[model samples]
Target: MRRRLLDIIHRFYLDAISRLPPAEFRRTTGLARGLHVGGHCFGPLHPVHNIVVNSIWYAAAFPVRRPAGSDDEDEANALLSTDGIARICHRSLDGLVAALRDLCPSLSNGDALWRLFSTSADLTAAVALANGVSKSINYLSKVLVPSSPHEPSVSPLMLSAQVLDCIASQKQQFKGIGNQVVNVVNMALQQYTQRSGEQLKLHSVCGASLLMEEGLENCYHINFLAYHEGSGSAVGAPVLFFTEAIILSCYETDIRLCVPVDPVTDIGCCFACESNRKMVVHPCYDEYLGGLEFQEDEVDYGSDFPSPLDVDYIFFDADRDSAFANYLWRDSTDH
Candidate 1:
């Protein structure tokens, strides 16, 4: 349930920014080279929020079935279901706020809480709007309740007519602080969702770009290298790319490295046999996915490396598991 809530909230934010004008879109999400947090910007953004937003964006952006039509609307158009809206404001608005208040107790003395809000002003505003909505809903629920026997009979159509008449006739006037607060709360559902969605996409793209860049530079061949960042327990594994789709990946105790010359057998072998002893093979298709693990022994750079007939030097890492070292291996004749 928590997972589903996060997913819905994520998609809500992503679709929001995708509909923005191209210029605003780029300014918010543009990439840069540096130590960054979410998207191209660096700040005190929480890592959990960053990871959650990025993961959601990754799934939405690279869906199993890429929707047909304009790129922007492919996945962002739908609003959350009625159930989701109910969840957001569940219980009486006052009840929900009271529950939240009980959990936090105080926000002013909390240095961490202040820091979180200070880092993201928009988030702070969204939170404030949420509070205002709770109060308004609580008040409305009480005042709008049916009165007793002495009250004039109010027909369903008469109530509907009154509502439509007010909406059609009265120009909404934002008067003083009270009306301003009300306006913000009313807009929170639309505004907050949009803002969050864009943030998620930006962060996700930033992370993916980093991994993809590494894979592209190291992975052999440019024909079609598909970069896949590991998640969960497999996170420690080397970043890897495959020229083809992966069908089955498993740990193999004994496997033969087919000779490069044999197209049929070579195709059967996994792309990079890192130290993990895991094997990923494509029985029916060409694409495969695997890790880029390296052995412990230091690669002797002093000695010359044998050049392959036509293949280019992909990557070389010495002291693979523990330390980081770069080694250059090139043969003039091999190229």
Candidate 2:
């Protein structure tokens, strides 16, 4: 059943990519590649994990392009409209959730976890709306501020006030949805623990945290850090996959955030001794990690076995790069 679900997910993912506009298709594929590279720095993830998260990220970050004569108000209204790629992705995600519910009938009985999956469509739409508003505000800011001394200068404070005023209603709507999302996430986590007999901790910086830490009211710039008790010794594949999925789902969504630092390279560079020539460390540490004597022995699995529990122990393979590239680039002109 799990393998069948994964196959359906893979097909849905490909269909979503195929339906995207040409430019967005390229951007989505590029984002997926970037995720693969960044994730490989930490550990190998199942290919389906990458596919699922990439689809979500692309949907969330999908922009609302304003018509040539359309005003900011029109664009804002359009953002909330049930149309375009965001809506398409929402349908695909809904189908995916329905399939899951069908496969696991237990989830249909007022399950909080099921509710989370259902509400994610709204969350994705909210994120897209936030992105649209952010872009609109940015555009207003540029237009309000004089580019040359010949024009009258606008006060920075007044500019900010005006921008905030313009998006006040939209901000309120987004805030309401954001609050609901947080509540749903909490309930979902509780439900997850009850069912799996495992407690997952989520350390997130957004909403109130953003206001407290950076005095930024931008709710789109979210960061999630999660772990389980076993994370210290050996992270379970499911935990790692879900963590990556959640983080990637929120990434590049009007946040304009910095790339996360590579932990292994940072640690090695900071702590390595300069006296030992053999101890020299570089950013490319994949070889060193592979050569470590303490590394676990990997069995030679000749076939791709996607487990029912969605935990697949695997290693990164350089040979797969070409195949991935081909897969992403194939049928590019069709859309």
Candidate 3:
């Protein structure tokens, strides 16, 4: 994960930016490189916000998707799920604030929190330009309640609407503090999902059961590379790009929320793996529905989030597990 990500960072990214169209360079100059690099006259009033925002903008192009097995993890758009990236950003945000304090000096305590707000707004714009609907849905998952593991409850659409109502017309706390970031993140995620709820809800449809539990640990590793900072136990397992879609406030007082949804293998009506930490929530399609059914907003499910199931990344001309190895093993390394 780190290798491919670093390659993209050093090669695909830098090469592209340095060779940007002259016109685009002039037009987006203020946006691409703001106060961080110290802009010229008429530059954006705030560069820190824009720089983080732009990273999110680029991230929208990379949506989270089912990880294809040995076939390779590259060429997949999902750099991070909404929750995944947010976690990353939370971490990165802290790192930036820590590194910046000694250097910027003027901004005192609580300043980092404010910067997160400004950066979040920029990310909102980026999400709008790309997968507007999925992003919207992603944001909505936070408030919506999924049904339990074994029940067929309210339709995702209906559940989503209720969740939206809670968010859109709420007197909820923190609603006004980071107003710009909160509203836009909510808007972009809601719209993104509404438009492509079908594809976005793939995991709910798959219904695959967990295959390898503790046995699979350390057997494989993942890497998620992206621009946002993060906090998690990818456990140094090469899970790069975990913050592809995130906004951060702070760790103890504030943290990014994420929902890592995986598509079920087309043959079932379930999801495979779902893992989460003590503080995070690991909701299922059913549990989310149940929450809405009972009007429960602050309910908590114990530490039992299932892990993700590996997909047949190498679906060539057959439909067997061996077929995965046959095709996926054709001259490639898992990115």
Candidate 4:
């Protein structure tokens, strides 16, 4: 009866996973695909549900091998002899099974079995599990309660919504980090000008410029680079096209001075320099206005500074132009 109940619970979880929207299903299945037992891919026909379930079962059944020797035993000689190693290995397997039996007592209890299946399928329960609260029956009971009384006991849609909320929270934190970096850079530039008696302007490139043709603004960090242009035609006159002025602010901030290594293969690296840190300033001295050329600093104080480590870099694929683009396409099509 217990075995039958577990099977039914597993089937219900599988049905919930299958019922997820195509995009959510793809996202969840992509996570599941990371569970390659021996670096083998499950072909297209293999159901993602089966892969995830079997992986969980395999992990639960085969816990880590514990050392069989006592505290005083020679750790270095533990695996010296084949027969001795085999004996220790067998003992470790036996110990793991016993440990699991003790940890999960009374599988015959339907409540215990239900708790196991429900927690496995619940994202919130996973978070609780990380904090060592999932094992508490009272906590699980409270957590597993449906938001709406009429809603199903557990659903993939709910889990997906939780995942999205977590993602949004993380994105906001990343944006904060980028903003902090920009503020720090600008303050440092001001300090440099005060000490050196030379004014340096801050020109910020839009985050969208760093993105691909239709990339999303999901970067988390900004970059910085500097260039000074000198005149070749006249002495002490601002150069038309010379490139060897050492911008002190650039050096003080440790910004990259050289271009990217490979433009095509590592275009992101090139753009990383362009969007966050690249500064091109020409100091023109004239007789009319006390030899001071005032150039308007074009600073993008908006929340659009691109990051060196964008979402595209994280979820890159050779077949797809961008994972974010695919997500947008699927989202629009679904709507």
Candidate 5:
């Protein structure tokens, strides 16, 4: 699988860069910077002890990641990314800041993120080319997904605890609410500095998880749990494969988000590691889940997961002004 994955990535690059008009190639070349094509592509791994407070935060859209003809999806019907658009936006922020400050800073701050994303049309095109080639190769080849051919592999885990912690702490980015305070202060700082580095406050500068949690209880923390909802002693999926894990946060005043960890990655991590990386697609990316938006009431997180006892929202912190807390999370099988 690793060989096949590399092959696909190589093909994608060749196909996309092959057609580039020179200037565009120079710009994209940087994305692959220090990205070892031969060696391990996964970044350094960090182990977290307590699952109660974790950093992984992501929601996935499998169809988009796999696309109609994509192969990874055939192995499993899910699209995933360890990092969310917000994280990607942060990494790509240098370009976005340029688009804003240099290309069209005068544009309403409200449109900043969108405009920046649109301006980088070339980058998206490049990603499409790479993704397309990956899909083609997946269909053409029978690659070993397990880290080793002899080992029955498990999928790679996406999103880390630190990343999720970062999102939870960033209040400004939570709502796409720009910091008026910083804009005013930065203007004054420009007076005497010879060379100033433009800093980005993740929350104050960007909107993340794209999905809206309008009427639901909006909270700041999230958690992932692994347990079968009394479905009998069973396997989560017959076979699972993925490149990235996704985190999505929406609705809640104060609560800890809980998620079910695939056993292989959690207590079951001893399972084999998948070699191929995947293109994760989280669609309706910006929409709220279950049509439940943040409301002026009690907050909840536990509700995201179901229990035979009863489904109730989890609240870590809350003001008693509002009463009554209840929610229904839409699951994949609901449809």
Candidate 6:
């Protein structure tokens, strides 16, 4: 699921970049840096973490203590370098930040992370590692345990103790909400940021889950957590895939309890209307899921997934004074 999500985001980001004129690429990169520095948080992995936290993770997992005169040193050194990952990182972030700015101007903060559009070595290293992890996982999937036509290999395990601890702590932190609106939004945001990084305070963020049932039956519901007056912010499809990837990383093990039915669906959030809070299957949504392909009879997955253009921003409002705490996605697109 993580690999699938990465592929979805990667394709979406690259496609979006490919669509842009070469001259606009610099502006897009600037906008992306602005969003990152301004705290425009995605699910869990924010742009800051792409440098800060990832640096720590990399250092801990692979120390720089290579044996003298050993080729292993070069390999380790290369892994720590950001030379190759720079392109992918810029492409991915530029697409997301630029699209959000175009779709909803309110989210921008005008503060670029860099003076101009350029990749930092730290960022390159972080993104390089992320891409490497995705590719490694994909390769392992093909070589792992095989299964019959009726069943597939067990999925990957999500048994990170750190992740479970975060979930428990967040549940406790949000248990004080009393109002329905605040409560709903609180829960949804919690779900969206489950395995990623610390939750950001934003009203435009929301979450949705796609659950597959027996046979080909599937369920899709939007979780309207963040709320504000006016309308909800638009979320590009790449954001959706990224959020899903974060959620999929939280579970303990591969869900193999059922056949012909997916063990789980992705839970992700973006800006949405108060009216969309209710759970129902819309025609556009069904078409969206059709592209995901859950079974043999299911439609073959396509290159296109949900894009920001496909969403309709509607009014979002909740009790601001309620005991439950919530963040709002502001109207500016600067950051």
- Per-candidate TM equals 0.16, 0.20, 0.16, 0.20, 0.14, 0.17
Better of 1 and 2 by lDDT: 2
lDDT of each: 0.29, 0.34, 0.30, 0.35, 0.26, 0.32
Error of 5 at 97 (Å): 3.4
Please list the Cα RMSD from the true structure of every candidate, rounded to 1 decimal place. 30.9, 28.9, 25.5, 24.7, 25.9, 25.4
Q: Residue 293 error for model 2, in Å?
A: 22
Q: Residue 181 deviation, candidate 1, in Å?
A: 45
Cα lDDT tens digits, model 6, 227-280, are 222344424211221121112222221221111111135321211211233222
Q: What ordering of candidates by lDDT runs from best to worst?
A: 4, 2, 6, 3, 1, 5
Q: Write the per-residue lDDT of candidate 2 for residues 226-300, one digit (tens) a residue.
A: 346574542443221111012223332232221222324433221111111122222323221112232122323
Candidate 6 global CA lDDT score: 0.32
Against the hidden true structure, what lDDT does model 1 obtain? 0.29
Model 5, range 286-310, lDDT digits (tens) per residue? Answer: 3213232334233332333333211
The residue pairs in collision within model 1 are 13-197, 14-197, 244-287, 244-288, 245-287
Question: Best-fitting candidate, measured by lDDT?
Answer: 4
- Summed over model 5, clashes come to 45
Window of ten residues with lowest summed lDDT in model 3:
201-210
Better of 2 and 6 by TM-score: 2
Q: Of the pair 2 and 4, which is ahead by lDDT?
A: 4
Better of 3 and 6 by lDDT: 6
Considering TM-score, which of the candidate structures 1 and 6 is the better prediction for this target?
6
lDDT of 2 at 191: 53
TM-score of 1: 0.16
